[model samples]
Target: MKRIMRALRRCLAVTAVLAAAFSLPATDAFASPTAPASPTPVVGGKRAAQGEFPFMVRLSMGCGGALYTQQIVLTAAHCVDGSGANTSITATGGVVDLQSSSAIKVKSTKVLQAPGYNGKGKDWALIKLAKPINQPTLKIATTTAYNSGTFTIAGWGATREGGGQQRYLNKATVPFVNDADCKKAYGDDLVPGDEICAGYLDQGGVDTCQGDSGGPMFRMDDAGAWIQVGIVSWGNGCAEPGYPGVYSEVSTFAAAIAQAASNL
Candidate 1:
């Protein structure tokens, strides 16, 4: 709940730095790879327990995702290439520690990226596993009702800016930032209704950084069920002042994601 965090996009990190240093326009980049890549870790977060987040998934290509169904994973569209047959991606779940013996691994058979994702907004995606994962699936929010307030974010991304990934899962909490304020910080880069912002805007600290891309931004519902509201998308830096972390507003694309999952 109290830590440094940022969106995990290796290329985006570099792009953000350049944009800041040179006063150039920001660009969004895909964080995942076509081949097997190292996973990233979360910084300044509390280590998660063995099964605290059963739906949490570690993508081989340096991102995170959530199990949407027995054989479907909901992630960021940028975490994968355009939706189609994809046999190179892998998903690991059921354990907080990447090296834990009880971890479950599954290969991906296909991917369904958002229909109109062009390196910008509409950054949600669905991945189909080769086989069903014997674990609980996470519930996703369908309306903007869950988009506000404090939310829980977890991942195996870097523990600090430009630091190495972690072996165990990290969990933290961040407050929601309104669109006006978010737009003031990101300008045209902040896509209203398509993206949600969360982090410490004033003091800076606590965010999901590089490697946490495609991960879920979730919170409990009134009935005590966890509902995912956003997907880690991009940010200027890891917990930098005035630049809150950006996420794909799941509510805006819930219907499309559901339809995509059914086809997958």
Candidate 2:
């Protein structure tokens, strides 16, 4: 019984660390929200039609991203945290289903995390492709305030906690939650400048899940073009009550993103 208990304790400790490091699984920690499940996909999202989100990309490392440019992709820092230029990470996009032959696959040649990313916050990252992809890129949110509107997040992540990765992309519409309400839900875990929270406050049916990390939380602009406002970061659980999904606020790093892309 002692050996069994020890093993269980160790497993729990590891789980807690992983939850803090990325969007994998949930734990009871105050700031350490769950990370997406390994090889799993989004939760409580509906099937997305092809060409609906042309900028969506699936990271080979079980995360999601948006095509920012011909060669630049935007995702969460945790998704490529310790990875480098030769990490064998592939960016697959331009298709709704993973099995489709129309999907464009590109190898990531470089990975750059935002400065001061400490695993807990500032979760955005930029990936450089080996070659340029010709598909339309998603615009970053600048003048718009994504703080209080219905936004769409799509990924090939788990549909439920501890589930497998989705074969096709899944999308969910989540309402923005104010900072005070979000802080009430996450307490010290909420980083106001770096993170934004969104989901149902009363019920718990819609959110991003495992393998959804680094995906885009976007909205249509006045001209009807999709603008990425957030990058899936972490949360307490998959659409759990009171705990909305947290994302890296794109507006907070808009200038940084432009500078980084320009330098590269």
Candidate 3:
């Protein structure tokens, strides 16, 4: 779910410059979209049955992200401009299929951009829908919890670069490299405090790409409840070595989100 909203690469030439100073094996070299033996989620890996949060609405106007609470539709700020009737967004979750949809139409949308978010990145938005949507509430991680290596992020975005609708929600897991490893590997490409990078260094396959922005980076705890520790923001083309995908720190913004939730 990479976003070009706030930090449209069009203007940030130097941004992609430093990160490209590295590379990882391409998809074909590593795993096919559906190579079963591959760890984490191989592309074409079995998509999670789409109805968990049947109420979970995926924002799809100019931006795309999953909706959690009915009143609180979480998304990246790049999704809205607060203008235009053509800004049509669809909310569908019963089953993942982007071929064509009569997804629940959002009569109106309000974008509450996250404060102090990355100015040149896709770290914004926690929309408040026009009405309360009846959906199961997903758990938000309360602690700064994450394990080093082998974690996953799930979403309904393009499985491959410029590919078609991966209508079914999909998951991709890669080794989660620590901050030091991330910095040592990505240098300026990963700005600490603003971005946290993760993925396998050796096998560049399995990762979150362009369509995954604003999706949840899940961490399963001892109890089995999935806690969202980060939000899919951006990355340098899926699973690039030294430079994995970047996530918005959930702990950093949890309190603000809690406050926002109270309003809902």
Ranking by lDDT: 1, 2, 3
On the 0 to 100 scale, the lDDT of residue 49 in model 1 is 83
TM-score of each: 0.85, 0.83, 0.72
Between candidates 2 and 3, which one is better according to TM-score? 2
Question: Could you tell me the C-alpha RMSD of candidate 3 in Å?
Answer: 7.9
lDDT tens digits, residue span 207-264, model 3: 6654456667766777975666666676666555555666766666677777766664
User: Which portions of model 2 show Cα errors greater than 4 Å?
Assistant: 1-41
52-142 in candidate 2: lDDT tens per residue?
Answer: 8888898877778898997999988777655456547888888987767788999988888888776666778899999987888999987
* Of candidates 2 and 1, the better by lDDT: 1
Best by the TM-score measure = 1
lDDT of 1 by residue, 1-264 (tens): 011122335222354442332242212122222322333335445767888899999887767899999899998877776878999888999998676689889999999889978767898889899998898999999998888889999987765566445557889889999999999998887789999999889987788886788999999998999999999998887878898889999989989888988888
Error of 2 at 91 (Å): 0.8
Tell me which residue pairs clash in candidate 3. 1-211, 1-212, 1-213, 2-210, 33-43, 70-133, 77-124, 96-167, 149-176
